[model samples]
Target: MTTYDFSNQTAIVTGGAQGIGGAITALLASQGARVAIWDMDAALAQETAERVGGGALAVQVDISDWDSVQAAIAKTVEVCGGVEILVNSAGIAGLNAPLADYPVDEFRKIVDINLNGTFLVNKAVVPVMTAKGYGRIVNIASVAGKEGNPNASAYSASKAAVIGLTKSLGKELAGQDISVNCVTPAAARTRIFDQMQQEHIDYMLSKIPRGRFLELDESAAMIAWLVSSENSFTTGATFDLSGGRATY
Candidate 1:
């Protein structure tokens, strides 16, 4: 595997306890970065930190809540000194149903965690990056956001908004050394699939031209680069990981 120097850096991976987030947490720590796994699951986060075995820190956080996000960052800063990299991998995939039949509360909950949560985490981290004038941010968007998956309106819409938010923030911080970008990945077989129906999962699989689901390690590879100093020029951009599904 290709590697980058993250020895002196500290990274915060929201939803870092498992799934794609867990893959990233392991990879970053393996590269010598002091990583902080921020997740809503305190026990799992601590377990992930322990398993990674690089002095990784775990802090429970509800990314959708401002107060909780604020406290998470404060604790992270106090413990890790400062954050040089951020990967917003925390999100949810709401139930699969047509927009007309979707539950009102479920839709709202999806947006609250996926879209608004991204905004809050980015808002909390930008200033810290600005203070040091060096940072790399990678928000995990979905291919559903770009292509608009059927029966997954809430997830698609919220992720689409994440793409938009990344662009706007990237431009706002372009003058600094910090880079803000997002990735639009096709579905990976993670716990997020537990929330999806079998039919919905099949539908997503059929849409991928590669005829297979995305792998967590594949995503971690792309994201690891995005959050590395090597990704110095790209910001406000969307990197596609759809395995031939993305035309643009």
Candidate 2:
């Protein structure tokens, strides 16, 4: 495992309670960064933070709501001192169904959490980063966003929006020291799989040329670098983690 120095840095990781986010939080903490876990699951967040144990704090947050996000950010800053790094990993994979047959409410919910949520969290954090003139942000997108997945229109669309948001924001902050970027990862077996149907899961697996699901630690390592000061010149770029699933 490559070690990156994060001494004196503070980071906020949404969805840090589990899955890829949990892995990220742990790595960041081990690298000497004070981490704040922003997640909806209070107990899980606290547990993960404790497990990380290097001044890791857990704050309940619903990234989809403006008020909720605002409160969470304030709380995180209050606890961790300031925000220098952010990893937007909190999101949901909506039900799989044909476009015409997709549930309207479900589609809206998916967008609300996956797309709008990223915007809200980014909006809340940019000013703080701007004031300091230094920061690193990594938004978690999906390969489905780049290459639309069958029967997963809502999820795909929401992730596509995330990619767009990351690009736009990265460019906006390019002149500054703050670097904002996103990653398009192929399917990884996480708790998120519980929300998806078996057919949908199998369909995603079939697309991965690697013939295996991505591990949480692999994604975490990539993200850890992206958020590190070492990744200075690459902003507004979408790093690929799709195992040959994305062409272009």
Candidate 3:
């Protein structure tokens, strides 16, 4: 396992209570970074923080709400000093249904959490990174953003927006040492799967030529490097973790 020194650095992993976010929190903490787990599930986030140890903290946040995001950043900075790294892994895969059949409220809800949430969190953290002139940020996007999936319009559109947002933010902060990037990963077996249909899951698998789902550790390995000082040169880039499913 390749290791990067994150000693004395503080990282914020939104949705860090479980799934891909949880894996990232564990990896960052293990490498000496004081990780802050931000999730909607306060209890699970606290459990994760305790398990990771090393000054890990759990901050409950509804990323969709600006006030909640504001509170989370304030609390995190108060406790962890300042955020040097951020991994926005909090997102959802809403119910799969044809565009015509998709409920209006459901679509709005999906966009609220996946798209607007990313915006609010990034907006809140950019100043902190800019103040210090150094930071690493990685927003979690989905392969569906690149290649639209049938019956998953809301998720695809929102993630596509995340990619665009990452690009714009990366360029905006290019003058500084901060690097902003995103990852478009294929499906992983996590709690988010509960919200998806079995057919949709199978369809996703069929599209991946690798015939396997992405692993949590694999994601952590890539993200660890992205958030490290070593990733200085790259910004406004999309790292693909789609298991051969991504053409570009």
Candidate 4:
């Protein structure tokens, strides 16, 4: 039996209260990392952090707001010592509708959280990682970004932006040992599903050739590797976890 050990590392997972983020948080904690969760939902975040154990904790944060994000990062650093791996998994699935029918405000909100949120968290952590000359970042993208979903225009575009940000940041930090990567997962049976109708769920499933929904464990497995010291020499690349749905 083998395991991925993240001992001696401090990790931070945004939206770590639930879904794939929750799984990642727990797994990392189990592997001996100090896991600190950042989420807008205070109670849920604390609950997940407690479940992770191993000196884990949760902080209420809105990643889109730099001020809020900055304070959250500060508190986590105080508790975890310093962040070694950062996973930008805080995101939202907006109302599914045609681009024409999408509300402008809603679109902006998605961008602010999905795209800008990633930026804020990275901005706050990169300098610390760079100084240490060792860091790993795994951002959560989407298969919809690869092959745009019909009614999820905002989501698709925001994820695409995340991929682009990963590429640019990876290059900027190429001189250092820090590597940046993103994962594009197909529609999974996450809490976001509750926001969608059955018709939409059926449509999403139809796109998955594997005929099954993505499990959070699967996503967490990939992310853990990306953040591990084992993931050397592979930066600025997007990992596709689309269950055979993504041709790219």
lDDT of each: 0.95, 0.93, 0.96, 0.91
**RMSD each, Å:** 0.6, 0.7, 0.5, 1.0
lDDT of 4: 0.91
Q: The CA-based lDDT of model 3 is what?
A: 0.96
Q: Model 1, 100-207: lDDT tens per residue? A: 999999999999999999999999999999999999999999999999999999999999999999999999999999999999999998999999999999988998
Per-residue C-alpha lDDT of model 4 across residues 1-248, encoded as one tens digit per residue: 12588898999899988999998998899999988889999999988877779888889999999999899888988877888999989999888999999999999999999999999999999988988899999999999888888888999899999999999999999889999999999888889988777877898899999999899999998998999999889999999999999987
Error of 3 at 30 (Å): 0.2
Which residue runs does candidate 1 get wrong by more than 4 Å? none
On residues 1-248, what C-alpha lDDT tens digit does candidate 2 reach at each position?
Answer: 88999989999999999999999999999999999999999999999988999989999989999999999988877887789999999999988889999999999999999999999999999998999999999999999999999999999999999999999998899999999999999989899999999988998999999999999999999999999999999999999999988996
Alpha-carbon shift of residue 214 in model 2 (angstroms): 0.3
Pairs that collide in candidate 4 are none
Residue 66 in candidate 2 has what lDDT?
99
Native-to-model Cα distance after best TM-score fit, residue 88 in candidate 4, in Å: 0.9
Error of 3 at 135 (Å): 0.2
TM-score of 4: 0.98
Q: TM-scores, in order shown?
A: 0.99, 0.99, 0.99, 0.98
Quote the lDDT for 48 in model 3: 98
